[model samples]
Target: MALIETRDLRRVYDLDAGRVVALDSVSLDIDKGDFVAVMGPSGSGKSTFMNLVGCLDKPTTGHYRLADTAVERLDADGLARLRNREIGFVFQQFNLLPRVDALGNVELPMVYAGFDRRTRRERALHALGRVGLAERAHHRPMQLSGGQQQRVAIARALVNGPSLLLADEPTGALDSRTANEIMALFQELNREGVTIVLVTHDAEVGRHAHRLIRFRDGRVTEDHRQVPVDARALAREAAE
Candidate 1:
């Protein structure tokens, strides 16, 4: 089923100079368990679309349905509740608490979800393990490398078992080598059936997804999937 559907989605800002259309009547659908990437230049509507999809902002017009819930009709509190349960976000900055260890960082979402201490601990450990960070669970963010820190951030995003993972420029701050490692992690998660929507300007990064959606001048310009990466390529990557 389509987990996300948007029909003529739009966002407009009333500026001093004139009305600015940040998003212009965009329509799209993303099915469950799909790995999709959104790519565009600075002024494109991709970021605006991401905000709407992430429930961080409301659309100016049209419809947005996420997991069968009409996003536009929800009140602020309702939206917050839905977001808490349904969306997991990974940002470019890693966004970890400097003093907090990996386990504590992963436990944060469960704390917000009101899980009991024991359950939170168990789930946090499992999530950290999923990201291959179990051994470093006690290490502070500053003690970890950039790739490891991003993995912790990924674990935190997964701790709540959210229906969707929304990543915004997740590798933007990392070096090429570190970025590839994180992308491989994302692929692993997707292979395990997590739905992912990644936003990036890098074409190589965007190509990692099962499908690509490109935006330009506040509208969608292309939506298509390319050939999957070969196993040989993946094996070579792993050996590096």
Candidate 2:
């Protein structure tokens, strides 16, 4: 079965100005290990779609089945559990606690999930190692570079061993070189069979994904497969 299946997914809001349609009749299936990028201009429904797909918000009217579980049927606690078990989120800001070191930040999710102290430390360290940040585990967020902070965020996201990763402009805050490094890490994760759904406004960033889906005016305007740009290759060429 597809990992994520949405049929006619629609979200509408009733504001003082009558009604607003944030998303309309959207349908798509994201397979396991798929690397899909969602792109659009402001108010194009991309963020709305991401919110719905990440289970942060429910659709006003539509069908969304995540891992064959009816998402629309889940209560608040069920939704929280599903998100904790099945989804990891990476944001543009690399939202780490300023006073905490990398290890502490990465352990937060496990703490919420009720992992034992020892287990949380072990898993957080392993996740940091996976993102090439093992040696920097003790560094606080302020002590790290932009790329390093973002790596810490990625490590935290992966610490849960989530099946699906939802990243919103993961590289948007970094310099070109740093952005390339982050994208390379994402590509590596994709190769290792982690499904990713990334939302970005940059076409260059979106081109790194295997599939592209574009939104416009509360609807899907484009969806297709493409040969992804090799982030590793780009980084190599830059170093040469």
Best by lDDT: 2
In order, the Cα lDDT scores of the candidates are 0.90, 0.91
Candidate 2 lDDT over residue span 1-240, tens digit each: 578999999999899988999999999998777789999999999999999999999999999998778999999998898888888999999999999999999999898899999999999999999999999999999999999999999999888988799999999999999999999999899877788999999999998999999999999999988855345543443564
Instruction: Give the range of the ten consecutive residues with the poorest summed lDDT in model 1.
Output: 228-237
Candidate 1 pairs with clashing backbones: none
lDDT of candidate 1 over 1-240, digit per residue (tens): 578999999999899999999999999988767789999999898999999999999999999999999999999988887777889899999999998899999998888788999998899899999999899999999999999999999999998888799999999999999999999999988877688999999999998998899999899999997645334534543564
lDDT of 2 at 81: 84
What TM-score does structure 2 among the candidates reach? Answer: 0.93
Candidate 1's TM-score reads 0.92
